[model samples]
Target: MNKRISTILLSALFSVSAFAAPTSYSVDPTHTFAVASWSHFGFSTPTAVFAGAEGTITYDAEKPAQSDIAISVSIETVDTFVDKLTEEFLGEDWFNAAMYPKATFVSTKVVPKGDNKFAVTGDLTIKGTTKTVTMDATLNGMGEHPMSKKQAIGFDAETVIKRSDFGIDQYVPYVGDEITLRLTTEAQAK
Candidate 1:
């Protein structure tokens, strides 16, 4: 019957749309940065900015849960504003940038939290140690970029990680074992 054929055709069309492939975007290193902050000896909080992030983000606007991200931050790019402290961080006492060189995060799961927010669980690796961590992320904006004239997406995420877990616990209770990481990124379709 005509009605039966129409129903089947409609179902097939919906199925195709539902299973559409996600879009891939290359991270814009110039617009992506990560800030790591920790309490320094209970007197003040010191923050360092890690620039020049590189990675890919596979995003599905229709089904955000299917989205995933992978990013790498170079240790050599860390800047703490103080020349002495920055040099110290690159040494063996802290991050040991010579050995690590980079820190990375690869998402394993993306859970939508409504209102353009998501709980992203991923494996974070630092100094060759990997640990599962979750970041509270928000989709900042998505559309054609003005400067690049390309489809672009932006996000902001925050997570707390313990340096001790990654074998970088120098002062522990004194310098604060837990470090807060905030990431802001913009990616463009490649």
Candidate 2:
């Protein structure tokens, strides 16, 4: 009877350990980028890249639904390739970077979609306007980093948002109101 009780207790402990709590990771700014693209008057598509994202991601491999992420990107980092256009994006007619320097996203829910994919619903705030959006996210890889030797995780996510909805309706239909946003990030365990 004593032996059976000890075995049961050990099994319970192992089972609990198998389902560990979520791990917090610090976003690696150098390895993260946010890209936005939109049609330019039916002629072509222009893309802008934003770098140096900062934030934290809480992840649970066993229970991905419990994970969440919060990140902020500086408006000043937006680069449209064209120097003149980049300046216009930061001006009052567009993002108004002087007044709102940072765009942020905070996850409200995470739903696992199988095969290391998830639908992450979050609140995105830009130029003081907050809107709820969902991104299709995939866990690209997760493990010890080859270079840093730290436990790291990488993800790629994409979503679509209307520029007009965020109060940045400069050209409207001419420049395409719908923008495709993509995020690529690698974070290390903190």
Candidate 3:
């Protein structure tokens, strides 16, 4: 090819490649978790955690609003420190893990809430029910991983949802109808 034509093609390729790569990161499961707690008998109680979670988040600091997150948690992996209670939670009485093994959250909008904080609006699906939940989040900043040689970022988010709204209202006056959730995620570049 002629020199001028070759130059044009190279420039086009570079520009195309620039937008082709989206900075993505994986949730470091060891450093990440989703914890939910509810008041027991109208009093404070130990928290319950949903273990065995895996997910990914893609973001661009330049365009903060373009960020998106997808998270999945195995319902049966819940740890309430009570064997029979955990089993019952996974049964038809609670999460129904047999039929719906996982719960998911997908972001639809992200709004800044000041001081590295944000309001992440998304649809949280549990037990085949979908509810629009706003998760308060904060970008814990970015850093370079010495071992993996990948960029990593941290985030902390929280949201509260009423269990009765999602058809998980088995507890009634015993267990609070509201569930408070907190998510701490450390994502490593993929």
lDDT of 3 by residue, 26-50 (tens): 9887777888988999767757788
For model 3, give the 10-residue run with minimal summed lDDT. 14-23
Residues 129-170 of candidate 2 have per-residue lDDT tens digits of 999999999999998999999989999999999999998887
TM-score (all chains, Cα) for each model: 0.89, 0.91, 0.85
Task: Please identify which of the two predictions, 2 or 3, would achieve the higher lDDT against the true structure.
Answer: 2
* lDDT score, candidate 1, position 119: 100
Please list the residue runs of candidate 2 whose C-alpha ends up more than 4 Å from where it truly belongs after superposition. Answer: 1-17
Model 1: lDDT to the true structure: 0.94
| Cα lDDT listed for each candidate | 0.94, 0.94, 0.85
Give the clash count for each candidate.
Answer: 0, 0, 0
Candidate 2, residue 41: how far the Cα is off, in Å:
1.0
> For residues 146-167, what per-residue lDDT tens digits would candidate 1 score against the true structure?
9989989999999999999988
Candidate 2, residue 154: Cα displacement in angstroms equals 0.7
